[model samples]
Target: MSGQNCWGYGGDNGPLNWHKQFPFAQGDRQSPIDIVSAQAVHDADLTPISISYSACTSLSICNSGHSVMVEFEDCGDKTVVSGGPLENPYKLKQFHFHWGQRGRQGSEHTVDGKSYPGELHLVHWNSTKYNTFGEAAVSHDGLAVVAVFLETGDKHANLHRLTDALYMVKFKETKAQFKDFDPQCLLPKCRDYWTYPGSLTTPPLHESVTWIVFKEPILVSEKQMDKFRMLLFSGEEDSEKQPMVDNFRPPQPLKGRTVLASFKL
Candidate 1:
């Protein structure tokens, strides 16, 4: 069921029914788990992560019928994330977002049972071990995703550049040229995070991601968030127009897996 697109976030084809098409949905290391901060073990060995994205070559932005994604040129090590829990430098493949209609309920991973308005996933592949992103996506230690929670507060100036372009790819399968947009600007001031072994929040739900969820959230205003909701799930030809909202997968069970914190609480 690799690359399958039949699933959605609605009645019959939603997350609850994803296991039927992609069995990995029921895997032991599935993602978007509720992060109980008190239970997370602080690992002193966990060093601060290093990110080099200034030289990133962003190609385009697209609406993949599920979320908004910005693709990058990952042919070289110009942009990469290393250190932390990762043994090798992972090249940045792409970055995307998951959001909700309202301001309080969109993030995939929750902290102490608290949900944020949105979440940002910076996906990277182990270019050293795997030839391509597809090859690395299924391997045990081939992918690393840096998750950042989005909170509602002041308007994020950098985010507006993305929201402004969302109108171009308002329909499913639509894409627009989005070059040289540095994703580094979207990150928060704090880099403290929690690390764990988990799977993709979306299908095919490969249990391959080394999750690095940040401790602090970047602020964006309600107006800025409303721009994301302006996107549509339906294609240009579809008779029914469904507004793209609540595109997040709910938190899964921790299943006794340990969550390691980079900083002590």
Candidate 2:
């Protein structure tokens, strides 16, 4: 995983071992960023976003080790990663997190001079064209996500949608009041991000994502960070460090891939 340990049924989720589980896992090579690159990007024009949250029936809210996730039903109306505009968009599906309870030890990407306690990922798919994530996995244009970094703060009054469901997701197939959620407000004021070709940070490790890492991080309070610690491996031996790391995958190799800063090339 992107953290210090692997997160699976056992300790096998480690980055070194992921390739065994999934042949495509990007455990081989990546710059292993200490994640200390949060400096303001040179030039970026953030996209206009509007996310309206409604009750999702198939949300699987659970804590594997990382942060909690509240998934939504998969509707084939997505065009988000279709390499197109929002008009013909993929339906927004699930949203999860990569987090640490305290300190900067567990961040995924090290920003310029700091690393927040965690990051949030809102997963979306392009169903308008691609029938399934499996099918989309092979195409260059498949998924689109908005990532928000969470730093320790006072207490996230607005993020109760995630915290309230922490203890409930013990087994799986769990659902909750992920009510009135919008995927837009989570973005940083600056839209200038590092756009690159990459794969899913989690399982399947599909190499079909249009990665858009925001140049800025969102605020997450200390108490808010602790909410993630509630995650368990469902057993004691899941990993020595419980809730500290969960589904984060190590950064894949730039693979000769060019990182496009929002600034002029």
Candidate 3:
């Protein structure tokens, strides 16, 4: 995975190619934005959502162009975040990171129009209620994601174990057990979030997703920031070292959609 071997940019997994690559990922309504908002229309049927964590067998931190992600694999126990009436309830899949220059913005979702320095995405899928993410695409409420924004501050460093694996992703097939880690701590106590339907920011820009972008951002240090910059892009060259920045897709037109929130405590 360290030799330009990943295939999202110019290869099979590229954003533009996803519709064809993944059957259910099709549709003109993909996310990452530019879909202009309608009169704050309504999703009167929305459900309450929350995330729960479990154990994992292995993890991989990679420089995925969007951010240096500490990707989880064979993870244990995925909890559902949404409530009743949802056609497809979401199940935790994996978590990844998105960052920008120390002083710049990198978050994909904005609050009342505010961007942050970085964002964390907890990707989940609807289990058949769809057999695969490919199948969930057409299911209105197919996929759900919990996002946490990261800001630079003096907050205790808890993500060190995550970034420490950046070197391991270059090797691929390698595994590491990340014990006793909890994603809830990575989330701010305030659960106010901007909700909308979006797509995978990475290549294959699959549109079948319901995004829950948090309002309050978590804190990280400068060292945590540099750890992200150390990721190697699957090849032994400096140019392959394109620092992971703006892996976020520019907000798409809101296209007559409503963005909801659960901020009121």
Candidate 4:
């Protein structure tokens, strides 16, 4: 019930069955909620977000039987994201992608019921208040996830670097050294976003994430996205190989939560 292999996006152990193992899966404040653009209230008091990932150290990339993630060195305040609903600056920990088999159904969080080809999650922890990422993850306001939607269009110049390294960690639980890649390059030009209180989209489903979902999506060609699909959800020793496509969790209920927009509707 606690191991990584116990849960997945398949019909047998998918989001629908996650609640059986992890009770928090059914909790309020869950993540990847459908963003009804008209319902988001513009908050003038909300300041623009500040990001400083230029000095961040990229450590490694791995496949965790779910998604391919790039870990970062967060020993100090070198890489941090602040402002825009966050009370204190959070340290960058890692970044990952959630995608689907096709070009139009990958994104976890949708805009006005519209889904994108994929989504990028730049995860940060409340280092200012908590000593470790683990200590912060279960607490309220302990994590900040910047979510950017990915659309199928022209080839993204920066994404190829990460996609090219996918072959090394094509199987689950495998990792390889990946250094010096700046996540700032993956973000879209527009800074406008919607902020909300939510939980982790994956297992454990901690209600600790302050979600900042961007309005604009970054463009990557369909071919580039296919590289992500090439990844497998099974281990090298496993009998059956499952393609790592449609790894994203569907949008959860909003309940009574308020979603605030940084700009005027």
lDDT of each: 0.91, 0.55, 0.58, 0.91
lDDT of 1 by residue, 1-265 (tens): 1223556899877998888888988889999899999999999999999999988999999988989899998658879999999999999989999899898899999999999999999999999999988989999998999999999999999988999999999999899999989999988899999999999888989999999999999999998899999999999999999999999999988888999999999
Span of ten consecutive residues with least summed lDDT in model 3: 1-10
Task: Tell me how far the alpha carbon of residue 166 in candidate 3 is from the true structure, in angstroms, after superposition.
Answer: 2.6
User: Which residue runs does candidate 3 get wrong by more than 4 Å?
Assistant: 1-28, 34-47, 55-67, 70-78, 84-88, 137-139, 170-180, 237-240
Tens-digit lDDT track for model 4 on 1-265? 1114557887867899989888988898998899999999999999999999989989999998899999988659879999999999999999999999997899999998999999999999999999888889999989999999999999999999999999999999999999999999999999999999999998898899999999999999998999999999999999999999999899999999999999997
Which segments of candidate 1 are over 4 A away from where they belong? 1-4
lDDT of 4 at 25: 88
lDDT tens digits, residue span 175-255, model 3: 344545566668787765567766666544556677776667888886777666555334444454444444554455565
Q: Write the per-residue lDDT of candidate 2 for residues 1-265, one digit (tens) a residue.
A: 2111233533666666767877766533232233323333333443434444433344455443444666566533431332222334555666777765456745565555356677777667667668876676556567666567777766666676567667676433333445445555565666545655566665556666665566667776776667676665444443443444433444445455455455443
TM-score of each: 0.97, 0.73, 0.74, 0.97
The candidate 1 region of ten consecutive residues with least summed lDDT is 1-10
**Where does the lowest 10-residue lDDT sum fall in candidate 2?**
78-87
Per-candidate clash tally: 0, 25, 24, 0
Which has the greatest lDDT?
A: 4
